[model samples]
Target chain A: MARSPFNADEAREAWRRYVSTGAVARRLLRRSTYHAWARCHDLGASPHLLKAEALSVSDTERLLAEQREFIAAATPFMAALSRAASSDRHAAMLGDGRGVVLDVVGDEASVRGPEAVPGPGCLLAEETAGANGIGSPLAEQGYVEFVGPEHFIGGFHPFTCQGVPIHDPQGRTVGVISTSVRRPAASQRLRDILVCAANGIEAELLRLRLERDVERVLASGSGSSLAKLRDDVVQTYAAARVRLEAAARRGPAASEYTLALVREAQRTIERFRHRAALWRDLASDELGMRQPFRLDQRVVEIVDLLATDAATRRVALVASMLEEARVVADARAASREIFGAIVSALENAGEGGSVEIAIRLARRERRAVVSVSASPAPGVAPAGPLAAQLAYEAAP
Target chain B: MTRERSGPGPSSGRDAERTALQRRVLLVDDDDDFRASVAEVLRDEGWEVTTAHDGEEALALARALDEFVLLVDYRMPGLNGGEVFEQMRGRSPSRLPAVLMTASKHVADLAAHHGFRHHVGKPFSLDDLLGTLELALRGGEPGE
Candidate 1:
């Protein structure tokens, strides 16, 4: 392969000058490249060489498991890029934002070379490997091409590399795609190829995320709509009943007859309102199941309300509380289930029994879980978990 | 020297009668029986009352009336109370004091959002309704 006219010695000279005089390497490098070089220096990385520190097999497996979705979405594009890299005797590497290479593909000779060869689980962060192709793009959050001696480490001077940062739907930098060639020259065409592949992967990630969201919505059904309709019906009936009673009181002569008729109509409307309210509550419960709520201050408020309720006055209620954390769940649904359990237990318990409820963060699961236990008076039967079943049956 | 009257006598009742006669209320509800009954009670109390069976009729009556307080039900058919009130506010040059009556516990929140002077929940006593109207007339807070 023909080498580019640009001399590698000039890049080395520029690096030496920048290191000794603390001057910017403007003519040979971009501003971002200089910033990356400074970051590497600040991180205490050696300018002459980098030690190979690959992640353990278990750590790599865990990372791959966590990023299964990303891998599934980017596989086809990565394969195509790998093919292109092989034709040029280069290597294509995909690394997470932390600069841990999750995948590497290319010709055996180029990928397995002794000097600065990256494999799966190899750490290429700027702090670890200095300002090279993967580390520079990861640091700058943009495309970067480093030729021969443009790399911060002298050991990497034999290879030319280009890299681009890949982003998720939210435009968060999630990973990097680095293409390295053993030849002295790195082409603009190579940089363009890596950028295109990154764009394709990002687009795929977005489509997959949207598909998952739509599926979730479809599974939850239209319970919220039904709940809203029931609310409207209940409101209308209540308004009508109020008006009928007022009319019955208007005239002294026909008051008895009018009152009797009003009473009949109100009885019918009241029955309908009661049924509609039940339906609304059920629908709301179902809707709550699909919704995610943070349990920070809301749990405290619910506990306070429960403590103030007339039903809890007869029993000793103890609540185990905790400082708030980022624990999210179907809080409304869960609360309804918990309330039902408590109500059942209290109703079944004999006079002078105590109930204990605990609301705390399950740190390992990263969620909030509520547990309730009731102790009945001597000779009284304990209430089972039948309340939750009843609640579920009642839900629309 | 002094005589106690059983009720407001002819001379003493004049001011009270005039105040009742001067007050006009536009009552809007969807149910025919409810509307008729409520309107009858308002008339018996000596106030001028106009009734509409639904939101559309309420808006039309509101537009034609020069001076009247609005007593609207929240969940009426067609435009519903809030929609009717919004349209009435938009079209009329003068702002009218409004009261929203509903069975929903969220009436207070609805009233706050829609700028109603008072909100009375349904199944309320006749005294409660009248008190709310009086409070609305005086531009006081929505008292229970």
Candidate 2:
């Protein structure tokens, strides 16, 4: 319903626009320095500024067409993480070394539809550590622990971001895993958790490469001549590309598709490394506590049904373990309550080991002491002032 | 895994004493006829119902009564939904579940500022309102 006195009507058109999708206002978040770095007036380019443009001859459209398959799968995961970081209990952000966010994930709906991948969303977009953690950590080439009111973006004074550089097997920094938050001291856990996750993924990638190289050597036969085997090694390296081609059919940008391809390839390769997945499972439980009610066992089973093969199953298993973890958590809380009651009972028994009307009045106030009302009163005068003082001392 | 309240448990028969609370619900709207229309439907659903004309009167009743749940429109003449929520928050009974009716996101934004647990967007029906009430007031489990 329209609340403004000027509008004066609670029509459906007005209602639907204001109420759906958990969306936030975009006009409030338009403070980015991406404009300074862009070489031209390309609406498609947000944060990325291509430095060596002289290298590509395909022009903007054709060159972007080639990279579409890569961006489709990757952009949204980064986007989802951004949205997740936004809800963090601490100050967090998604930025490059250049400056604060020019645009954000939630409002990306406005930039919908198929488009070429621009340089704006890539790691090269990074610069120095500002108030935002992403740029700062990237600049430092290591983990940074930034606290509240220490940020460069004044509007983001409420947030703290901690990003770790995502390196490929070659130890070259390829991307970043950052936690954007609004609380103090959250940067450490978020930073370490993400860094560990990214490392696990990279380890899986390296393992897969190793596996493929070994298989090729065996396939070509170890008895082969040195010259022939050297050729085989190069061929295997080329064939075992870790970057999978995403469907340009979804219309993602070049860089976006490339990131997706890398992630998907890593997931496929990661299945061979069962230990890494288990570590991720444990981290998921530790870091993702603020998520609202989790999927039930049946829902987890439903997820199991939706996925096919090893990579999909890896995603689904995380959901199943979360369900199992909840059962243990609930039981622990109940046992704690039971332990409290048992301790109270033992303490009552320890004091004289008997109960009567005289003893009842002598017990502490508020701790109702039971006695036989039917029995004749005890002959002894109950323990008084000094005993009361002793009982008071032990009351806690 | 079950524990019975037989010996040394909380005092017996506390549940039976709480049954006499007013089951009637007073839902206020500028649309008195529409309010009555819904009241008749609620009567069919077996609830005694009452209606108020505006936010100011609604807030007064919400403070004075213990049993009824208020469903108020967001954009009303004197004291809008946000004003009503803030004043109600002052009263001990403000935690009582409220169903806010709004045709815009601004209603949600305002309700969020005042800590309303839930809201029903317009183009909704009496059924939607009832479901939200069962959820917020009854603590009914939402879809798993």
Candidate 3:
């Protein structure tokens, strides 16, 4: 049998009892709402608090500007969700992870009155607003529905609200989507719509992030790098297939080993994906022979890209660098040599080994010096016309 | 619960309908031969398969349909598997479990990063493919 709908009258009576006697009627409230109310009481929040805090006019405008991408990603979804809810007494809102309202749509009257509509810049974090839809989700980093009397503060008792936190690609809550209805008995349909909209908004945010990375690649002037990255992705699979076929030819004994080989190839591609942008940087250097760029940034980027590979090999790659260390040379030659030197060093270090990359400015020599050193060090010493670049020095 | 191919035919209309609904899936890949072959296998296994050649095409189908799992290739031109999965997830109103198909070595990490519970490596056996898909349908993690 389906569970009965939420009872606001029973919740109201329970809330009064809890506020006066510190006792909870668990059956009358959702566990999430009960916990949120407990947290509010622990923080010494007043049940009689009349309104939520609002930001100053300038602060509100600044917040609106700061959350531009978040609002832009969520606007269409919020509008659609609001339309689907299709109630004149319902309002949808978008709030930052900090519980500050960024955007609100639908019936403004739902949030109207002494508590404020939580339009732009209203700070509804649980400490201030007391277990509200917007603020509770941010605090708990999950979905929260505070229906009418479920709100710790009496001011919110006239409204039923549900909030769902939106997460970034890394799974951190970046913002929240919420719905508010004027009456206590909220429709379940509106809550479902809000949750779906939140998920969709997060997906859009990830797409936008990828777009920005693409723009960065174009801005870095590495069109060829995009092609190179694409080629790398294609070649990775082809190479894995070759390895598999070779292992198969070696007989049945190689089956287990072939799986390992495929696993390693998979890691290579994963690392490649992780450092796809860095590949673009390398491609940029592959252009313009006399172009002067910060050798420090280049070295740092290489280190960042190789860090995962190094971890897999059980070798630590550490770097010490001087800021703004510029080197004017065949940028491609400098980067290639530096990358080769580091790879050689990582190899020489062996398992449980360490390779240090240092970038220093030799003011007297008027050059930015880079050195890759390992315990045993690489076999071949630095011998190149790119002396203006750096040296592959051994650490004694 | 495993469904025996021998059980209830079209005569059992409700069971057939329920099974069909439960077995629906979207297969996205740029490789025509691979996609077609996999779709055939899945169809043979009693799955209702929808195929897309690219991310954009997959997104269009996803928007048009609902309540199906996604089996996507990690690499494809214009949007790739990761982007397509995310975009579809954003556009849909329900949880859509997915299984990744990739030739890359770090298949596990790639699948996890892209929010896929399971992955089938390239040059995989028929059993491996079906098993992974079943695991995803069950909402189980890779090992489980």
Best by DockQ: 1
Clashing pairs in 3: A200-B90, A265-B105, A266-B104, A266-B105, A266-B106, A267-B105, A267-B106
Estimate, for each residue in A46-150, the C-alpha lDDT of model 3 and write its tens digit: 777777779999999998998998898787667655664554477788999999999888764554644446688888888888899898998888878877888
| Predicted chain B of candidate 2, TM-score versus the true chain B | 0.71
- lDDT (C-alpha, whole model) for all candidates: 0.62, 0.37, 0.66
Candidate 1 lDDT tens digits, A1-396: 212345567677767886677554656554556567768878887775655467999998999899888776666556545654554677788888888888777777766766447787878898888887777898888888787777887777777888898887677889888888888876544454456567656645644553344345446874332323344444434444444444323333454554454454445454443434333333343644444444435444444434423131365556665335444345556555555566555555535676666555655555555556677777767655422221111111
Interface RMSD of 3: 13.8
TM-score of each model, paired residue for residue: 0.39, 0.26, 0.43
| Cα lDDT for residue A59, candidate 1 | 92
Best by lDDT: 3
The regions of model 1 sitting more than 4 angstroms off are: A1-7, A16-30, A113-116, A222-396, B1-144
Model 2 stretches astray by more than 4 angstroms: A1-119, A122-131, A153-158, A182-189, A207-215, A218-396, B1-144
DockQ of each candidate relative to the true complex = 0.10, 0.01, 0.05
Candidate 3, position A100, lDDT: 92
RMSD of 3: 17.2
Query: In order, what is each prediction's RMSD in angstroms?
Result: 26.8, 27.2, 17.2
Candidate achieving higher TM-score, 1 or 3: 3
Q: Is candidate 1 or candidate 2 better by lDDT?
A: 1
